[model samples]
Target: MVELPKRHKLEQSNRTREDEKLREFDEDIPDLRSLVIPWASMVIVAVIAAGIVLYNNHCDGEHSEDQLFFQSSDTMVEGSSYKESILERFLSAVTVEQHHVHKPVYEENHPSLFPLTTADRLGFSFVIIGLMVAAGGGIGGGGILVPIYILVMGFSPKHAIPLSNITVFGGAIANMILNVEKRHPLADRPLIDWDLILVMEPLTIAGALLGAFLNKLLPEVLLTIMLVILLSFTAYTSLKKAVKMYKAESRALREQGLKPDGTKESELTHINHQVEATDTNKAGDELLKDMDLQEGESPGTGDMESLAADKADELQKILDEERVTPMYNVSLLVGLFVFIISINMAKGGGAFPSPIGIKCGTYSFWMANGIMLGTIFLFCVYVRAYLVERFKAKERCGYKYVNGDIQWNSRATIVYPCICCLAGFFAGMFGVGGGIVKGPLMLAMEVHPAVASASSACMILFTSFTATTSFFVFGLLDPQYAPVCFGIGFIATYFGQIGLSILMKRSQRNSYIAFSIGGGVALSAVLMTIQSVLSLAEGEQHKSGGICGKDS
Candidate 1:
């Protein structure tokens, strides 16, 4: 009885300490009322999600709703060169609903993994859906696509990496178009970093082309290993940066002396997607001003002053809620490694860029070099112009809070290029626009979140389009993948965008939310990496056996 009392006391003490820690954690996190969704929105979302699940579960035939336009031609799977074990692995997860096709669409031992047979059309649709989701997860969907193709689709690493870039071209295009509409309507005066884009565009183009060319030299197994490593790094960068955002937000809030309202962790915010079709351009703004103007007051007088004040308040609010979480030096250095490797690749990769053009497959060494050198020269000029402008700005006015100012809180001056280089290479190599990766990098460089997202969206479009075109011209891309990848990806992105908007509206979408996503992606990347290594080993063995048989 005496020992039992002592045990109870010890348990009570431990519980008290745990409760205290929980209280501290609660206090540390910010209250984001905007993240809370209403009950009605939640119900609607649940209904929609259930409907989708039920529909997918029941019906599993047809390429899409309109079968007349969608059909497999050159892209159809015909041979049995693809690894069978890997094919079975992916197919095992999916439901085979090709009972309608009585005749076999292709040979049983066909090497092709996708569109298994006329009966396997059901599986192909699932793949399209998966790719769509993957694209939305990564900045341009290319990062996720490569993994899916290799680990799930059972494609050769060389083919998967390049095709990954090509397939998500539609998503990038969609993302770009959306950003354009958002940023470029006169009065909207989108908070774009044009100078930054101009300075970086050349690097992006040169770096991607170089990466694409270099991609050809590596052995298949080596390439898969490299791709896996790249995925891990990309995953880490996304997640780590996200993790640091919470404290940064708190710090920024403290600096601004603004704290959000108190809300329980258990209560999630519900956001209703009530979009009003308003003319949200400069003209509309001016028109609104005109309507608000007093009989004797000019449009420029009081209206401008009020608008300025409102703008300032809005900016301050955003600033107060966000913090400048600079990336670690080690993290930034990894990017520098990528830049150095890019330079080395240009210098050491196979054929020299001779004065006389030399054609290697679809690429001309001299032409590519010439274009790169020209872009480098332009980049240099832009840098000089930027420096002069900065000097002039400093001389004219001392440091003051300006809208869209580059507010890097750490050693970000040299790090920006490394970021651009890594993102560019990855974009070119995989056809993933790297916008998702770049957006976080921009954020790390102290660019505003809104600006970062907008800038990333624009760049993603360019990167994907360039990568896709480059592959197509180089004869590495098949036009067949485009119809499926682009059409489904395009539609998926629209719905994905809407969902993201709704989620953001219902919750405080800050660093924490971003961190969760990055962590999830990184976890997936790790698994894919393991699977890729095994697949590569198995493939090499299979090749060796075939060679031995031929010799015998």
Candidate 2:
């Protein structure tokens, strides 16, 4: 604080001024510069990313049609074009020849055999019939209606297949919407039999290719013979099942001590009376209750109670064993063989292996068919494992439920995927939707017919979608013909839906409705077989016109 000389004061004043300038410079600086550079870099990167996304979207919008075309052509390969062209020419030639021969008669007088003129009316009639069946409570009214449309409207199998495929697609989409609205979860998780699917895919595809090749090369007579044999076998199976069911019911009634005058009511009444008159309490029921209580109980029950409990346990164990044992194995070798043969038949002669002049290596329809079957099998195996684990978890938890509300054990669910895979493979292999297989498989799974139908509807929708995509990609979808097939099928599908709904509703009132539906189905199948055979014979006759006896 002491006063200094003039020279020292001047130097101190200069130092103070320099220090003030330095403090000012430090005050202007900010630590945020480090953060700002990184943040700005990040923002720039985000902007670039967004721009890329926008560009892609714009490009996609500009060339969507081209993309679809490219996707379609991916599976067309080398030889499909030539084969399709030849087939088209053949069909066109046949159509022209037939039309020329029939034109004069039609011009002179309206013939009842002309199925196309009333195709629309026939379709409407099918809708009405389907509605009537639904109101009356029958099974498969939709299935019935469409086949009627096919036969009555004079649609060929090729046309019918595409039409049916579209119908299934639309109907399934509608159902999916309805189900979603009802809060049913769409299955995102895959369920299937991987092992079988893996093995069968290659085999099935090989078969399809082999069959398609054979169809092309084989004589019409041989193809027709094979088809007839296959159809005969199918019919035999159906008839056998019907007969077997009838016999089983008869035998069951006899065992129940019922008279020859067959009445379920009488049999039920006798059984009820017998059960009611016997011990009011079942030994198993008491034993189960005891088992639940015994975990916290003393070492053992007294002698008499223990003896009684043991007896009950033994009886309960026996019944439990019976309940667990499977009565049949439809996923085994025999079933697999039947499924393969059925698939071959369904695909028709056109799908058989035929070597066109254009290609050297075998062109296989089975590549796709086999993949589908194999995928289904893989799905079944996966589902089986999933169900097994779920059952184990439930058992571990000892989850309880009211009677009839008991969760299906792993065993039941496991069986379904297997059954579904086999049936679907057969159906798809034959190029059919496999509704017959789906219906029976669903029923076998202990699902109610109504529920089965609904599920089948869902399954068919997926199958149609997959098949259509594959066919389209492979260039099997002829644009010129697609509209015709789709238009007729779409109308028919709507009609079928109406009819199916009516039949399902009516089924609750009549026990025999399913049987009646079955009869109709069988009849339609027979008619279809006859038609196919006749067509094949006609083709053969044309091929050997000079050698064979010709019409005068």
The parts of candidate 1 lying over 4 Å away from their true place are 1-138, 154-163, 183-192, 210-230, 246-357, 361-367, 387-391, 394-404, 407-415, 425-433, 474-479, 516-524, 527-531, 540-552
TM-score of every prediction relative to native: 0.51, 0.44
> Model 1 misses residue 538 by how many Å?
2.6
> Candidate 2: global Cα-lDDT?
0.38
Q: Which ten residues in a row have the lowest lDDT in candidate 1?
A: 543-552
Q: Looking at candidate 2, what is the lDDT of residue 304?
A: 34
Model 2, position 462, has a per-residue lDDT of: 44
Worst 10 residues of 2 by lDDT: 97-106
- The whole-model lDDT of each prediction reads 0.44, 0.38
> Please, what are the lDDT tens digits per residue for candidate 2 over residues 329-374?
2144234444544454443223222222111121333343454467
Q: Report lDDT (Cα) of residue 405, candidate 2.
A: 19
